[model samples]
Target: MTTTTTLKEQVLMTLKRQQANALVLYLNYKKYHWLTYGPLFRELHLLFEEQGAAVFASIDELAERSLILDGQPVADPADYLGTATVTPSSGQLTVKAMIEEAIANHELIITEMHQDADVATEAGDIGTADLYTRLVQTHQKHRWFLKELLAKGDGLVS
Candidate 1:
């Protein structure tokens, strides 16, 4: 492959990493949606489903962008879960634990995206940079949302 193509491949890897992180979180959110029970059931159920949709949409975009960069998008569930840097779930966590895990994943994704954005910018990959910038903002919003839940307590009651 040419230099440009190599750069595109790297960008593809970055995008895949990003999408994988979101996918994991999305699944966790949906799990929380099903498992959450309390007075906040209705509120948290709707909220988690909404968040899942948002992350699901993001996964599509990330995969599309990878294809645009002349790489095959990593859409296989096994592939995503296999490669993601986010902590793997054992499906045993409570609702509050789920929330805390999502927050941590968001922070991790932000850091990864920032690094990828810097690399893309240095490589003159403006599209990748822009996409990663948007991703950073999105993750930050997610982190803020989770922080709202965490700030009031030890992340269990809120």
Candidate 2:
């Protein structure tokens, strides 16, 4: 591939990468929500719903942004699963374990997103940069939520 690729190509590639990650995480969050138990079930269920909602929203924005950049988006779930760098399936595990898995996944996405932001910046793609930065913030929020689960599950006063 040429170094001086069109802005659309860079954006589409990055968004595809992100979309793959987001789709996996979104479904994983829903899985956790459905299977969660214990005293924290209500709180965690709501939190997962919110987190899943946000991930879905972010994907919508990212996919639309790719369209704005004049590229087709990867929308099918099978395509996402095939392309995702983050594996979503880990089989049955404890609720807390699921939360921890999600945290790890989100952090992984964050690292990739930072690199994606740098790529967008290098390409002078401000729109994609803004999207990736927002995504990072969203991942941080989800990480905090999952961390809170660990803290709460541990019987902490906080």
Say which candidate scores most in lDDT: 2
Return the lDDT, model 1, position 49.
Answer: 88
Q: What digit string (tens of lDDT, one per residue) describes model 1 on residues 1-158?
A: 24656666777778888878778878777788888776667877887888778888888888888888777877676798876787666667766787788888888888999989987887688998999998789788878886787687753444
TM values, all candidates: 0.88, 0.89
Count the clashes in each prediction: 0, 0
Candidate 2: regions farther than 4 A off: 1-8, 152-158
How good is model 1 by TM-score?
0.88
> How well does candidate 1 score on lDDT at residue 117?
96
Could you give candidate 2's per-residue lDDT for residues 1-158 as a string of tens digits?
Answer: 25788755766787887888888889998998898887778888898889999998888887898888878788776798877887885788787688888989988999989988988898788989998998899899889878876774455212
Which pairs of residues clash in candidate 2, taking residues 3 or more apart in a chain or in different chains? Answer: none
Residue 8 Cα positional deviation in candidate 1, in Å, after optimal superposition: 2.6
